[model samples]
Structure formats: C-alpha cells, structure tokens
Target: GKDGSPLLCGSIPGLVPKQLRFCRNYIEIMPSVAEGVKLGIQECQHQFRGRRWNCTTIDDSLAIFGPVLDKATRESAFVHAIASAGVAFAVTRSCAEGTSTICGCDSHHKGPPGEGWKWGGCSEDADFGVLVSREFADARENRPDARSAMNKHNNEAGRTTILDHMHLKCKCHGLSGSCEVKTCWWAQPDFRAIGDFLKDKYDSASEMVVEKHRESRGWVETLRAKYSLFKPPTERDLVYYENSPNFCEPNPETGSFGTRDRTCNVTSHGIDGCDLLCCGRGHNTRTEKRKEKCHCIFHWCCYVSCQECIRIYDVHTCK
Candidate 1:
C-alpha cells in the first residue's frame, strides 16, 4: 500500500478528476493525496466527536466527499481547510524524503540567525506543497458563485496555515558541553498542531457574502458587513456562505444524521454533554462493569505483577 506510482484520479468513484489534473505534475504523490483526504475526514470526525453532526460517511467510499464539501457551512470551511492542509503536509514530507521529484527542501528564509545555529538540514518544502495544493484543490471551484469563491478561499487558507506554522528545529554540537554552535532547519509542524489551529478557526468561522463587483467585473465573496464589526477578515480567515443546520434530527437534505442513541458525557454542559446532545429528550443511564489490570506491585527487576480489578461506571446514551 505504500507503493509509489502514478495515481489516476478517475479510477476513484467519488474523486473529481477534472480538477485533479491541475496537479498532474504531482501525480507521483497521488497516494499522499488519497491519504490526505482520509486524514481530513478523520480529523473532521475527531473535532466533531461530541457534536450532533459527527461527520458521518455516505454510502460511497469517499464519493460523497466532493458534494458534501460543496455546502457553504462552517463545517464545509473546516473540511476544506483540513483537507487542503493534509495534502500540503503529505506532499511536503514526500518531497523531503525524495519520494517525489516535483519539489524539494525550501531553502528560503531559514529561522533567525542570532540563535547560534546554522541552517543545514533538508526541511520539507511547504511552499511547493501550497502551490501544488492550490492548483489541484482549487481547480474544482470554477464557478463564479459565492459557494465556489468561499471554497477556493478556504482551501488557500488551509495551505497558508502549513507555511505559517513551519518552525526551526536544531541539533547542538561542536563543544563538549555547550550549544555554542548548532545546525537548525525549518520543519513542518505536526498534523495535530494544524488540526488545533483549524479547529479554533472553525469555532469562529464567519458567514460571508458573494457578490458581483461592478468595478472589478468579477465575483467576490467576503465577510458580510454585519460580521465585519470587529475587523475585516484577512486572506487567512475561514469564511462560509451559509449557517449550519441545527443538526438535532436526521435531515438527509442537510446531511445531519441526528443524535439519537449517540453516547454522551453525563457531566458535560456543552454540545457533547447529555443535555444538548439529547436535545432535551433526556438520556438513559446504565451501569457498565469491566475488568482491568490493577493493584500492581513493582518488582525488584524489570517485571511487575498485578491483580484483576472490577470497575463499574455509568454509561449515558440518548434515548
């Protein structure tokens, strides 16, 4: 499964081949692209684990992803950002490892020099990753409509986050006990960092507007004037064109699968908590018991002994 080869986008049922060709030069990293999409889905499900609409999948394997992305809700913005960031991270790493030839270590501005370190290691090329991601992911957003504009902008925002989070990592040497001299290199931040940053953006996502600019003679989408009270959004901000549904009941049209029978935290007062998740239908609680290794005693050497312990806890689920 780790084999590196040319991936034909059209071979996948739900994948959009038309826009994929925009990144034809990156065909060698096609496996990375598919992995990125899966990573995005996983991240989405993780982020929404406690919420009502918990990122469920459709009948087709990855086929529903493109259409699900077309919606202009806050969820859609998060999906686009996470998915695009996944691609950027994957391709950049592949480039650093010599698996892909279209890109290499970005020797651009290394970290600050006063830190007593010299840049040396081959860092992943986030610049190349972002460029390739924009070409492929944004290609599907061809319409001049607001939804398309929002998608393109959110996709770019995701790629930009990868570049913004690239940091300098270093190793010290040359002296017996001091870091007087060191070798540092730019490294892409971990996926969790990207996921956390994108989650924060998702929490504050703004509902936006798409309109024709008479002077510019093209379509433009931006945060509505009402949403601009604090400040106008920079290019990096995530913007959406529609408000999300309540997501309390199964609405096939809106993509909500409802929260009935979903597990919840009894102590939580927020979305994942029993109150909100059950939508006031109230929840059922049952006692669950399990056995686990416990009451352990440390041995003089490398081994420890333990006795089985029975644990009982209350499990809560929507009625």
Candidate 2:
C-alpha cells in the first residue's frame, strides 16, 4: 500500500497517448471522466434506439463502436459531440458535488444582481470540465486530416450545447413564506435535455466538403459547407463530410448491422414507423401476452390485494 504504483489510470483501456498523460496527471477525476463517457454512450443509444444505426457497441473491443466511427458521417459527428458533452457534464456535476479537491463551485459572477435575486449559492464550474474534456477527447484528433477537423468541430459543438443551456437557478429567502431575497446559481441543464438538443442537431446537421491546402509544415484539411445558399453552420451546429450508408442490409464495408430484426412502431409514420424502419420490406406481426396486476381492493388494514390479469397485444418486427 505504501509503494508508489499507478493504479486505476494505468489499467484503463482504450486511451490514446495524450489521454493517458491527462489521466495520469488527474487520476482523481478519472472516475467522473469514465462516468461522463458512459453518460454520453447511454444517451446516444437512447436517442438512436429507433433508428437504423442504433448506436450499438462491441463487447469484445475497447473501440466499442468499432469501425463504425471511422468515417466522417453525420453519425460520427453526433457521437463525438455527445461524448465530449458528456465528459463536461459529468465533471461539472462532480465539481459541484465536491468530488474533487482541485476544483469546486464557480465563484465568478458574470454581472450585477437581477430584480431581487443575487448570486450566492455555489454555482457549477463548467469551464474546468470543458477544459478536461478537451484535453482528453480532443487528444484523439491530433492529426491534420479532414476527419480530425470534423470531429473537433463536433466536439466543440457538444460542449457548446451545455454552455448554451446553462441558466440561473434561484431559491427564495423571506419571512414566513413571503418573498424578500433570492439567491441564484448557474446550473447545467438535465442530461436528457442535452441529449434531445444534440439529437435535433443531428437531424439538421450540415454537410461539409474537405479542402486541402499546403501549410508551412505540411498539408492541412479544412471543412466548408457543401451548399452555397444555406447559411454556414456555427460552432454549435454538427458538421459531416460524408453521407451515412442506408443500413438497410448487413454490410461489413459500411459497418452497418442492418435492421432486419429491429422492432418497429406500426402506427408511426416517422423514422421508427414500420414503413421506414423496415425499408419497404414490410414487417411481421405476432401476438404477445403480458401478465400484470389488475383489479385491486383496499383492505381494512390499508393493504391492497390485486388479481393477476393476462393481456394480449400485437408485436411487430422488421422482416
């Protein structure tokens, strides 16, 4: 126990070089970092569960998504952005919760007091979280390639989403239920809200073209909007350089597992609808019985008794 040996930071898998450096330097923050990555991944799956890609992860490898993220598709942009945002969100939350000694609540007040509210509570320090996320997530995009540029942009967009949603949360202080003074603090939005915002960004993501030029050191790739009339995407908009595959059939080339057995909503006309999810292949319907507690009666002692009931419903899956 006395020996100075690297513990958790040394054993974590899938970290690139720069991330390893950051991990070793800030070992105490690693748990929050891991939690952040998990949050990002879980949110990604939740947001894409009804879609073709589905944000599936590989169990056998550290690169969980495998080569699915190797391309510069809109999916890749969403993943990068969400992951980055997740890291920041988690770390910022940890800071407010007093999990780390290196950081704590933000004491800097941006402006003067509003109406009756004054800055007094411990505001979440998101800037530190963003810095740590950039150090680790941006480390993987060191190369001067088009994909790297696209990824970095999307990552920033994810972090910006958090910043954009930050708002003042206030509590009232007064005599006997009357409002007299209000203390406020800056707080991050709920992670689900962030996920929903990112999903919206994914749907309307901008398509970009790669432009390579010679610099003093070597060639560098930059991204530009493909369409001329469309307004240029800001720092908060997701950008992709390549289109995603249809993912209708299993194709190893495009890293698509297909939607052959995916569940579909029969009544929906949107992306999750059988018509779109099945790709015109139609769907198969089968009856499923579900058991649940049905009729219940309150007893004299206050406990309730319920009868078991069986219910039948139609289940649909892509053919």
Candidate 3:
C-alpha cells in the first residue's frame, strides 16, 4: 500500500513535490460533493437538535436541508470578512416589520431587508464595512419592483443620502409574522448634528434656556412673533459673527449671574427686541417653578423699565 502513487504522495503534505503544491492548494480550497452533503447533514442536525425526525422521503430531506447548508455557507463568508477586517458585526433575529412606517416599506410588497453588523472605523471617512449575501443580491436583481420601491424609500427617508454604507446579514429566522431576513446600515454622527445646529440657529439663547424648564408655555409663541422670518444661520453667518467686533462685547458678564445671592435677572424683549420688560429677577421668578425656593425679589419696576429701554433706546441690540 506504500507505493509511490500520486494519492499517497499528496496525502503526505511535506513529501508532496513542489510542482504539485498548486494542485494540492486548489483541491484543498475547492468545494466538493462530499463536503456539500456533509454540510447539508450538519444543517439538518442544527435545525432539529433534540427532535427525532423521520424523513418521509429522500426529496423531503433534501428540500429541508438544502437552504440550511446554503445559509451556513453565506454566514461563513460574512464571518471571514469580519475576521479579516477586524470589524465587529451583529445579526438580527428578524427583519424590521414596523420599519415600513419609518423606512417606507408599506407602499411596496417587499423591500430591501436590513441585516448585518456595523464596525466603527478609525477615521470619519472609514466609517463602515458590509458583507452582502447572495439572497440580497438575487432579490435586487430579480425583484425590480420591490427594489425600486426600496430605493425610493431610501431616498425619501434620507437613508441612502444620509447613511454611509449598508450590508446584508447572513442569517435568517423563519419568515412568519415579519420576514426574518436581516440587514443593517451605518451612519455618521455628524450627519445627525445638523438638526440640533439648525434649531440653535433660529432660537435665541434665552429660548434655549427656557426650553429646559418644565413648563414654559409662551416661549415658543413669543419667539414666533419676532423670528418668523429668521433663517437658520449658515457657515457664512458664523464666520461673519466671529470676525465682527461687536460679537463678544454685546453682553459682558459682570459676574456669575445665577448664584443664590445675586441672580442675573432675565427680562422679556418683545418680538423686535424693541420692548424689553424685566418680568422677574432671581432664579425662581420665572413662569416655571424652580427646584429650590429663591429669596430674590421679583421687581415689577425693573421689568417695566427694561421694556421701555428696549423699545425707546434699543438697549439690548445684538452685536
């Protein structure tokens, strides 16, 4: 049995001829019928772990086992990508059913499934890595209508526009109440900061403080009256403000304003900043109640004087 045959030579790895290394590597990497059958058997074992399964027919066993093997292979590819790239990823147990409301999947029968895991990259530019599955590829190709609907939704929801990248998760739970097909996408945090920055641009600094209160009923109403025509400040506006001499000295702080003894008194300046009225003084004098009771006096005279000053002399003009 120890004859100098090719099979015997190949079986002994170190003894194999250098010329045959390529062939050996190819054989090692290539898929085979035996491997496929073994994979099918393993999948069946995973699916019915503790059950005594009696296959009624050969066709039934093959039908039941085929998809499991296919799924395993797909998952292996995803795992390989994760390992190679040193990226963290996760698989959802099921597809997002209610996402139609947020992601707009209702208008169409089926949509691009969200699944897979995301990894944080070192740089802002290196944000995400994705491993697409064969099923996802096929869905995109075969289902034109569904794909189109998803594309439309992605555009509308700003997912494609806002998100950096997307990848399919190589896992599936049974498609029942909601399709268990999983998928996921990556987004940059800076993109979400736009809304907050825009809000701050339109609102006054006082409005920002009042918004933190428990009950500030008239703040929005007051702001709307004056700043209805105000647009969000752009980069140009910020640059101009930075370069302007009046930007910093408009309201120089004499001392810390919100301490227990001497609180910086806030007054209401009407929509045009033309009518300033000191509605109250001290931290506790606002329409909204403070956490601790304050001893500061709420002077009506100061409120009236401030209002008169703003209207008559433009005392609180923005620098």
Candidate 4:
C-alpha cells in the first residue's frame, strides 16, 4: 500500500490477513517506539543547549536533524549513545574549527599531549574563546544574536577600563590635584562595581568640609565671648582732658605772691616797652600773660589724662 506514512520495514507484496497480523502489530508499535526515540533526541538537544558552543553551528545542526530523526529507533541503547555522541561531536568540532580559523591554526594537527587534548594554544586566545562561547550560549537561550551580544560585552569591558583609570587619577585632594571637570562615570552599568568606591571618596570629602566649618564656628564664638565685657570711650573726652592749664603753688617770701605792680623794661618791636611782673596769689593757681607767645601746660596728671583718653578713644573709633 502506497500510504502517505513512511515504511518502517521491507514492503510485503499481496499477503493474506492472518499472515500479516504480526507485521501489523509491529507497525502498530512503531509510533510509540518513535516517540521514545524522539524523547532521547530531545534530551540530547537540551544537554547540547546547556553546553557553551557557537550559535550558528548549533542552530544549523538542529535544523538538519530535526525532521530526519523524528522517527528514529529507541529500542537499542547503542543507538542512543551514538546519537548523543554525534551531537557532542558536532558542537565540539564547530568550536575547534572556528578557533583554528580565527587563530590561523591547522585543525587537523594534534594539540599538545594532555587529558583533554585540545588544539588551541590554551592561553589568552582560548580564554577569550571560552568567554565568547559562554556569551553565545546566553544569547541563544535569550533568543538574541550571538555576535551582537559578544560585541556588547567587549564594548562594556573597554568602557569599564577607561572609567577605572580616570577614577584612580582623579584624587581631588588639594595636595594632589583635582579633575577640572566632574564626571559621573560611576553611574554607567559597566562601572557599577566601582560606584561604591567613588561614593566612599565623595562621602569622605563631605565630612571633611563639615568638620572644618564646625571648628571655625567654635573659634568665632570663643572670641566673641572673651571681648564682650570692655566698653570704649568718646572723642570729646580725648580733646578736653588733653588741653587744660597747669598751676604750681607760689612762695610768698620770694615776692612771688601778690607782687602784681613790679614792672620791667624790655625791647618790643624796636621800642622800649614796660611790662608788669607779679605772682598773682599764694595759692597753687598761677597765671602769666605774654604777647606773641603760645602757652602750654606740662604736668604728670595731664600726661596720664591724655594717655588714657587716647587709648579709650582709639577702641571706640576702631569699632
């Protein structure tokens, strides 16, 4: 019978009904058997998906085998092992070939003697490849383009390095130097880890400013309280106390008391002139008048008066 379903066994031409019962039973069980094989294939695909490998190659292999292995045999353990091995082999081969092509290495050559026996140099290049593979797996699981995801990772790494270098150099200390312009590279996703580091530095600076202001305020308060008690003097007091007349007591025996009538001849303006000479009284008050002469008072009391007056006036004038 040329039915639409695929033939599992050799075609049997024109057989009787009872003769074909055994064959029919086997045919009846084929869907269940195929279901088991499908389960095994699905498990293998899951395991491969979990492994880190190139996205393009994995997708291509899955697309090719998806329909062909839909009706595969599940009765034999050997077939299951072979299928799993096949999947693993395809993934590993794709990774190895891609690495060799990028690094200009011959994939056919055996790598150095080791347990894993890989062909790559197993240094920086291998590590980079491993990182790429892990990122590729992530992209696959997330249903994104692996190449674009890898590019994003590389760009972030580069930006992070630049931000870290800038942060290190920008000490902002007066002893060192400050960054002429402030930057918030810490807010970027790539530099998020160093955000805490920058925040600690910023907090430290803020604390210092607050402490300095507190100390300055304390010093000003102390000065204000100390100088609050003294009062200053006025300018009028300075002038009056500095210009008063001084007197000494007169001696009566020397004709220095009440001798107002005595006169002396003196030359005044090229002519002879007479002037009166007398000590006015026996008291401490003495007075003498002379023409064209400026009089000044000299006494210890006057000196002290003037000095105190000037000192007090200066404080008030300053304020």
Q: What C-alpha lDDT do the candidate models reach, one value each?
A: 0.78, 0.91, 0.24, 0.26
The better-scoring model by lDDT among 3 and 4 is 4
Q: Candidate 4 on 16-65: residue-level lDDT in tens?
A: 34324433543433233234334334544333321111011124443433
Q: How far does residue 177 in candidate 1 sit from its true spot (Å)?
A: 6.5
Assess the local accuracy of residue 170 in candidate 4 as a C-alpha lDDT between 0 and 100.
16
Cα displacement (angstroms), candidate 2, residue 172, comes to 2.4
RMSD from true fold, candidate 2? 1.9
RMSD list, candidates in order: 3.2, 1.9, 32.0, 50.5
Model 2 residue 86 CA deviation in Å: 0.3
Give me the overall lDDT of model 4: 0.26
Highest TM-score: give the candidate number: 2
Model 4 lDDT at residue 294: 29
Q: Which residue segments of model 2 deviate by more than 4 Å?
A: 1-5, 297-304
TM-score of each: 0.88, 0.94, 0.15, 0.15
lDDT of 3: 0.24
Q: Per-residue lDDT for 139-191 in model 3, tens only? A: 22222232232222211222212122332223333557353433332223332
Q: What is candidate 3's TM-score against the reference?
A: 0.15
Better of 1 and 4 by TM-score: 1
Across 1-319, the per-residue lDDT of candidate 1 in tens digits comes to 2233225554555445665454354567777776777777788888888988787778554545434554688888988899998888888888888876566777776545765778777877888877767776787787656777788888988988998998888888876857888877789998888888998998887667665554375655434634667676666788887778887887767777778899999988999999999899899999999999999999999799999999998999997
lDDT of 1 at 186: 80
